[model samples]
Target: MSRLGSFAGDKMKTRGRKVRGSAYLAVPFVLLAFVATASTAFAATESTSKTAIFARVTWKVVKPGDAVDFDLQITNGARLGEDPVTYDLKILDLPEGWQEKFFYQGEQVKSLTLKPGESLTVTVEILTAPNSSTGIYQLTFMAYSWMAEYASTQSLSVELREPIREINLVATFPGIVAQVGETVQHSIVIQNRGESGESLRLSALAPEGWSTRFITQDKSEVSSVYLAAGQSITLALETETTDNATPGGYTLTVRASSEDGVVNALMELMIALREKENVSDFDFVSRFPEVTAEAGKSLTYPITLRNLSANDQEIILSVVTAPEKWKTAFKSGDTEVTRITLNPSQSLDLIFQATPPSEVSVGDYSIVVEAESGSTVKQVVFKAKVVGLYKLDVQPSTLYTSVTAGNPLTTTVKVTNSGLSPVTTLSIQVTAPSGWDVSFSPARALSLDPKDSYSFTVTVVPPSNTVAGDYLISVKALSDQYVSDEVQLRVTVEAPTSWALAGVVVAVIAVSLLIFIFKKFSRR
Candidate 1:
């Protein structure tokens, strides 16, 4: 019995040893797996911390059928000298029928590479469907780096709304003068101030028996025009007046309408008509009956003379009435003439010159000119208005000055109003050589009466390194109405006193040394 018990005990001991051996072998595998998991987790954390994604605007409000762009930057915050990492880009949770694309440097891209401590910019363009409903849509953009095993995501939202539609119509000249059997032309501008392009039909409503048409600058007639957003076009409206049209005022309506008639613009124009003058044996006309001239100046008027008589006739021209001390003359091709002969149905061009006195007051004067041929007589009235002249004269106290380098030189300048009117808002300006400084004591003046003058103190400083030479400086007086002639001043730059003294000392030393050398050699 003892022997049998011993055998059983030995078998139990063997089984216990095998169990312990199996446990010891499994402990190494478990520890190795734990260490591997910890290392992997550390690597993932390190990589994620070194990468980032950023977007300036993550939310925006947009209109239906509009494209939205989100600018994003992918940054690798890892230490420099590390290898570049390539990131794969993707869009998540995008609605169906909506298109998405990524662009880098204007080219479509699916992936981008960024060096350590460097960043790359990319654009995510999202195009919404034309018929998209008004609501808020959210989209996610993700970037994954295969080398670093890291990922970053950015969320963006867009609120779609209805678009605004608008149109503008403008008339350059809303009033026009026309004679019977004459075609009157008017200019109109159309603009589309909307978020999309549109097709607009142009039409005009005129009085009965009048024809109207819309034509472009190239003379091409167009019933409809296409205008893009913020686009403008100029069109001409031509209207024909009837031969027997009564003398009255009429209103014409101009309109521009979109394709759907939802957007429209309207403008009203006024047309005035008068009776045509009867035919006569002689005709005299002046295009400009009134003219504005400056005091102490001469003005000329162009006149047309036609002889409708059946025979050759001699016409006499003369000024019947004019302002006292004012001179008037009629010239044909630079030759003074008092009478001219013209054949039947012949025309002659004449120039009428009028000069106002220097001391003429500011007012309007009427002058009557007459032309007579046998029994037929024609007269024209001209109005001339004299306006005040604006002139400025800039004078300096001294035209020339001398200055040493690195020193300031001050001079007085006078500004005079040599005009017939007062000068206001006057200021003085000084232009000097480069690296020089200039300043004025009183920078601006409120007003200067006629023949009055104002004095200004100008200080100029030259740079320390300026070479000894001559430089030109200019000063001028300016006002809101006119600018005076530039007054030039010559500035002579000389060496500093210390430098001159030093040069003298050097010369004396050299002369003394030469004398000593000569005496010593003579004695030898």
Candidate 2:
């Protein structure tokens, strides 16, 4: 070789040698490329990469309280075969107040054997600093190895929480007997049920037509006083039912969430409205025949009392003032039907034997009955008199009651109210002997007046197959006001099988004719 050309050959050989820095730079890139290839081993690269970063980490976070969690991640980034390999962190990428305790596995990694898809887990604390920011932050992470600089880093995110103040409010309101729409001024027993004294916060939710205010023992401003656990404060909630407010029950919920993650709870308020007495359904039963009485005697009205509200109610049951010269005996049905005291949705019947004023005719008299239940009262009015004349005169002057089985024994029941007043809503029924069916034909609603008589058909049917025998028939009549005394239904049922003899004779004739024909034919 020429002397100069020999020198150039030496230079070219020297230039061809790989620089240590170039090797360093290629490390991360190779590692990254390997990882990329392994990730998509079957995938082709869309473009070539000039640089890459990779991470070797198993990131984790810890829970400090019920409200928060902390996490950390660690990774390394290096240039391929580079000297003094180092990394830089961007503050803008991290949370404003979050403390990023950068954990570096190493400044430089010198491994070429790393194939694609290889990774290691390391710890890097992304902790909430004492002075952590109040908003979300994103941090980028990258890692690298010798052969190639592995690329990529996950973005870590965090939520920053603001310091809050603790508040506890409690109240003890008094029981009240309020009329409908009545205003209740209530004082509540309040307490700071929390830890660490604080500038206690006090507030009220929507209270109906009500106002709230705190009353400190020392009259401290409710806004600024530091309240410790077990400490107490008083507040008043004033509200009144509207003039048109519905009478019933209501609830109010007041809450307290503690600052500094202290204790939290709430108070509940229950309000009730009292109502006036009103009448609902009212009915009556008589104490005469079957609930019977003499023609000259008076009847008792058994009235029932009922409560229809959710609250326990007390009702005052009473009879109105009696007219001069009147006689009556009254008793509560408690001893008769039910012995237990009645509660809500409960009722009791009372029987009153009210006689017409001495000079009053033996007729229905308007009697007023009143019941007072708690703050509720009701009055009911009904009429009663000398029970019907019951001199039920059967038409034709006699109840000729003879009925064959399968026949209707119709008789005119002239129920005359010989007494003075009109009888309304008469429900009549006729009873019969066992095995004998009885019914009132032309079934209907009926009403009768003083000395007035009603005519209705009473029907009795004896079974068509009734055996020859005598059966006593009976009848009963019930009205809204009275039940008639059971009347004797003198009925005789005869053996109605007389047609059996006729059927037998016909059968005998038919047999003889058949026999005669057979004999004649044989002879021929």
Model number with the top TM-score: 1
Which portions of model 2 show Cα errors greater than 4 Å?
1-133, 137-158, 163-408, 414-425, 431-439, 446-453, 461-465, 478-488, 494-524
lDDT of each: 0.83, 0.49
Given candidate 2, what's the lDDT at residue 486? 65
lDDT of 1 by residue, 1-524 (tens): 24323322342233111112346566556546644643453345344557788999998767867889999998888788888888888775566567779999899999988888888999999888787767666566667665444556666777777666789988878999887777999999999998778899999999999999999999999999999989999999999989889988999999999999999999899899988655467888899889999988987888999988888889999999999999999999889989999999999989889998776767899999999888778999999998879899998999989999999999999999888777789999999999999999798999988879999999999997799999999999999888988999999999899999999999999999999999999999
What lDDT is reached at residue 523 by model 2?
Answer: 98
lDDT of 2 at 231: 79
Per-residue lDDT of model 2, residues 15-106, tens digit only? 11111333646656654663463345212211232223333333323222112222223233223454432333222244334443433363
